[model samples]
Target: MNERLLLDHLLVRGPASRADLAKITGLSKPTVSAALAGMEDSGLVHLAGEVLGRPGPVTSLYDVTAGAAHIGAVDIGRDWIRVAVADLRGRFVGRKDGRNAAKNSEDLVSRVRELAQAAAGQAGLPWTSVITAVVGSPGVYDKDADRMIFAPNLPGWEGSGLGDRLRTALGVDVTIENDINLAALGEHAYGAGHGIANFALVSIGTGVGMGIVVNGELYVGARGAAGEVSFLPAPEPVPADDDTLRHGLTESLAAAPGVVRAARAAGLHLDTAKEVFTAAAEGDPAALEVVHAEGRRIGGLIVAVASVLDPELVVLTGGVGHNLALLGDAITSRFAELGPLRPRVVASTLGDSGVLLGAVARALSQAWDHIFDLRQSGVQPRQSGVQYGMSR
Candidate 1:
């Protein structure tokens, strides 16, 4: 208990001497000394440096061994796959980003494995050495079904036994989560939503989704589908086609593809949403109109979220949603046209790295828990808890 308490302090506040640890942790100096010695012998803490010109004897500072264990974070998106290896301190030691050209779930699994190995290699460690890994994808992982659901952007990703296959491929403990949810966590941990207790992250890209944070913790609903906002009803008439049914109305009308579709309808001749946004930035009237319409759609979505969540802020992210400068006016106008409720909105500062950073943050927490459990059980830290397991 003393060791864990001291270790937690060190992890949060950097290095501290035995006297300081005792003062902060409210333990006796002798108890702090014993705990630090035990942790040092276990390779979990190390003497960082000594304060030279102190009043009495030299005060030796100790810190958690950040490199004692490593964690892996993966972000799987429609257009890209990002992998990062981070130490116990949540600092990325190695990272790799690659274009995703996967045609099937099998290919995607293989690609993720390759990227994990490559990232681990860059960190001068083997992939097996990673204590835990968190994968951020675009669907709700159904533990009972052992497969992803509500993910239409990735082909063949909803197949049964998908979770097992990913574990087999990655050869480590893995947790699959919604990419947008992870982005919210990223913002809460390191970006725009930092220090805010209640906020929502709405991502408009290849697909539309939201992540909710309440009371400083993520709320994923009863079945982990809390923020699947794509299915919400829209003002625009939605087609009764199979594709529309699969992706839902709000996503079909508000996502990047929808932006491009509106741009083409406005005679902009743009193929991608990026192109449409670029044209709008270059002051094309047609493109601007399309963008404003898209923004209004997003604004409607935000209003719906605020009515229920009443979050302190709503962070807009993803490829199309990040253009808050262009979307702000239309969003505000739509807010006026709608009811009286208007939530604070801003663009995501984390960019494409949000999911990856969130994954790292979660993996670090898991690694710490595993380490503590092993230590309490009198087992070697690296012997168990390295195999595949779903995070609940």
Candidate 2:
């Protein structure tokens, strides 16, 4: 499996020298040399360049050849569908991001097809060339039913045959996952959570959710509802309407609309959450008060999560959570007053690309697994989606 291991590492981290690969995989010099020779003979890898300005001997770097295979990743949000296509070597081919106007399951399927095809076209590959596709959506995915649940923010998504429709439309193996969970994976692999053993990412956006990573792996509980933090009881009074109940309690208090409500109650004429943050930056008392309250609510949620899981880091993200400059000091003060051993809170550096990048990471994982399995079994790898059921 040395060649398999080398290829996988290169696909993830890009090109590297034999010494670097050996160091990363803990393989010896002779073992790495043999594996590289075999991979080069098989036409899977080629010499990219040589590193200069090193201490001693010059090192030759190898990269995976392009057009070996393709993977598609999609981020399906309430208002947009972002699509990206990458090759087996982890090189991006194309991307398409557009408004989501789907009102129901059928419309959703059509929109996904259109976006995926356009992305593949831009990448100079046919849509049929895509081998595997992973979709990051906003809900707890019930794999048994193959539909989304507890996703009130996405109207008409619950109980719909969205998953099967996507599979049929895309004509590839499809896997559905919670968007926030994907964001956590994105952050862990490429952003703030890198190198942290245990951490929690709390996203405050159109809705509130948490994604927990423990011991360098995503910890989705039985029935895939581990990080559904929005249902936690609200700390303050909320709208108390049927719609608000459908949306969770904590979410109604900490998400974007919650900020607007706090502003209006304080007699501020702000129209959106961004405006409120802007007003606060300008030193408006009413807006600053709302900002402080929102920070406290977020800080309380962080404390609650820390008390149970005790993660080392807490990454704040999403539409409301990413305003770190405004909320950072307030959240820190709230936690400091409470007690010791509180997790350090930080903002997401990945920004809007978190979900989509995570989808790509997951898709490449599955694709590589299938390729390795084919090599082991002496069977040719096909474009069909390899069947595997993973916890969301």
Candidate 3:
């Protein structure tokens, strides 16, 4: 069984020949064969046909059955809910995200349920075929307590049974994490930080947040608030006689509110930063200045982060991350001026779904651990999704 688990890992992580799987798992050819036979019987593994070999019969390769299991990822934000159904191999089967502010916490939960169902339907799965579901919430959390500590965006999120409710409603093991943290994890596992040992994900949007990956592990931090970089005060003091426009910190200056506020000051009355960015992208001079100034705010922080953490990469993501084309030069120039230990600065690779993608990855990781750990603990694996009529 242990050899079988090792063989499973080999097939899932990468396509491998039986010899390679035996070498990696430290098993004999017969042991590998027995494990492969079992996995094949279970529909979890299949041969990739013959690989050309040198002066010998073709060697067969084995790979995972990616469609055998599926995962669900949900992103719950102040103004929207995004849901995606991803196959076992991390291929996006289907997705849906729409901008609709929840009237209250109940409405938010209901909307997420609706979106998850819709996503699964689009993916051609039964209403509940997901093995695990991970959610991206708007605030910090204490996973130990299954409690949200401070999620200002989701009014009734913290100090409640939202996790329990979500798990019950979705009929899957539910895990919730901050969107920015999930974004960082997503990038680490599948995006830009595929092999880096250390990095930071600086998300600039409705709020500014950072996620640190140290020694190839996501740094959850003391109290789970390690990367709330927006709360960091500005190094330079506010000028005594300056306009109110000059905020204390760089993130407030660079973040969405700051940009929209600056645009409004420049004779643009955009209620949301979306309006500001739209006008800015369409060649509005006032909106352009807002983006430029927003760059200055983000630039200083980027330099500060680079100098402090000295990570290998710093990726900017979120709603505002897309505007890097408009603001990249100014921010990069400022960062270079300030740092000797500057890291690579890049925009998001996976677009706005980076966080949701990360959530999916996180859920998959947990499911992976659950597969091994529960057996060791003499506990049966809980069925991840609604088991159709089987459970009922």
Best by lDDT: 1
Best-performing candidate as measured by TM-score = 1
Tell me the whole-model lDDT of each prediction, alpha carbons only.
0.90, 0.85, 0.75
Which digits, one per residue and each the tens of the lDDT, describe model 1 over residues 56-90? 89989999888888899999999999999998888
Better of 1 and 2 by TM-score: 1
- Which should have the higher lDDT, number 1 or number 3? 1
At residue 270, candidate 1 shows an lDDT of: 79
Model 3 lDDT tens row, 1-392: 75446645764577788887788778898888887775665555688677885677788888876776678899887777899998767778989897757776677778888888889888888656787888988678676777776565566677667788788788888888888899899999888877888999998877678888999999977787888776677544533333322222545565677677778879998988878878888998888888877776777887878777889988888778667888787787777777565568888788878888898888777655654444354432233442211233
- Worst lDDT run of 10 residues, candidate 2, spans 383-392
Q: 202 in model 2: Cα distance from truth in Å? A: 0.7
Model 3 residue pairs with clashes: none
Q: What RMSD, rounded to one decimal, does every model reach? A: 2.7, 4.3, 4.4
Ordered from best to worst TM-score, the candidate numbers read 1, 2, 3
What's the TM for model 2?
0.88
What overall lDDT, based on C-alpha atoms, would model 1 receive against the true structure?
Answer: 0.90
Stretches of candidate 3 above 4 Å error? Answer: 1-14, 51-59, 234-252, 278-283, 336-341, 373-392
